[model samples]
Target: MSAAIPPADESLYAPLQAAAWRLGHLGQSLDGFIGTAGGRADAINGPENLDHLHRLRALADAVVVGAGTVVADDPRLTVRRVAGDNPVRVVVDPRGALLPDHRVFQDGAAPTLQASLEPGPAPGRAERLVVARRDGALALDDLFAQLAARGLRRIFVEGGGQTVSRCLAAGLLDRLQLCLAPLLLGGGRRGLAVPEAASMAEALRAPCRTYAMGADVLFDFDLSV
Candidate 1:
């Protein structure tokens, strides 16, 4: 319904120009937890961060998420907090584990697509794109290829931890915008779990910039390096 993203917020996502740019984000606690052990994730960031999220969604061609996020949040994945057109919703549900009646599938605000291993009936109005399985898992390369073929570039990979972790581990993420809240979740879901560094020399390092968004601190990393 809206025409374009606001200029102020647009400045936050100017790096996403290419068709294959994959930017990921997660709202984590001080202890690096994205959600509780039982998959409960509520508002961790304040107004500014939420607006930032909507702006990111507005600029993206598609918003990608895993089946776990779909099942846990049932988010509409639309640009509602700001004025902009909603992006296409992409669900990486290789096993078709997400519920058919989820709100993401029911919402008619944006075009929805599900990438799965087995071709079957799509939930609601979503179109199913069968991604061939590799080693009994969905091949990230093939999935992105298919999405690119469909003209979906500038993807926003928003998360549950597993999805973000997989993308981070696979080196598929171009940029990472992490909003860290002050709260602490001592025994909750991790923000990211990748291969451990053997030593300080083998650690992953990248240029990062920080910003204060209300009560949260946003860290923007150039993961492409």
Candidate 2:
């Protein structure tokens, strides 16, 4: 049986009202793939789910994405689908893979912060935030502390799998919202690439709630619980 769709409003994001929180979101197919083999992931979810993403951006003090997402999508990361101020845009590019011409760096729609381990000139008007490397990856805890020092407490980790997965594994995400679309890509990129569990007993579990968003089903997991 199909689940009842909830009303589209601010109430849908009420859980984010906590004083300090980090939220990670991913939209994947029914088969647990976020994109196809060719790296096409545009519009995987329905319009309502897209609006939900924008709502998340609206509520957050900063919206973060990995360099891979910027290289692939070049999103502006603005709050256009809903009525709210655009949050500060943050790009995690530890390898310096992205060029300065990306939309997020060039658009100037909102303040942009490029977090990286390398020291270089920031593209366009984006500011450079030097981060440390731990175990060959950017230290997410250092990044979070820096962000908090900058008065960005409400964080939204909107991503292309690797970034979200790293945050999830590091115990940085307070909540995770996984939206599942009806379509299934037989073979493609997987979502939430966390470390393999030895058995079902070792699998990560959390208290969750469900909401229907148009044709997609949103799974809201409270990992902090």
lDDT of 2 by residue, 6-110 (tens): 355445566677768999999999888887776657779999888888878888899999888887787889988777889999999997667898999998999
Query: What would the TM-scores of all predictions be?
Result: 0.93, 0.93
Q: lDDT of all the models against the reference?
A: 0.84, 0.87
Supply candidate 2's per-residue lDDT for 141: 90
Clashing residue pairs, backbone N/CA/C < 3 A, model 1: none
- Which lDDT value does model 1 have at 134? 82
How far off is residue 139 in model 2, in Å?
Answer: 0.5
Q: Write the per-residue lDDT of candidate 1 for residues 1-225, one digit (tens) a residue.
A: 543545654545567645568988999999988888776676777888888888788878889999988877788899988788899999999987677898878878899999899999999989898998888889877888888888887788998788888888878898988899999989777887878899999997789888888889998999877
TM-score quality measure for candidate 1:
0.93
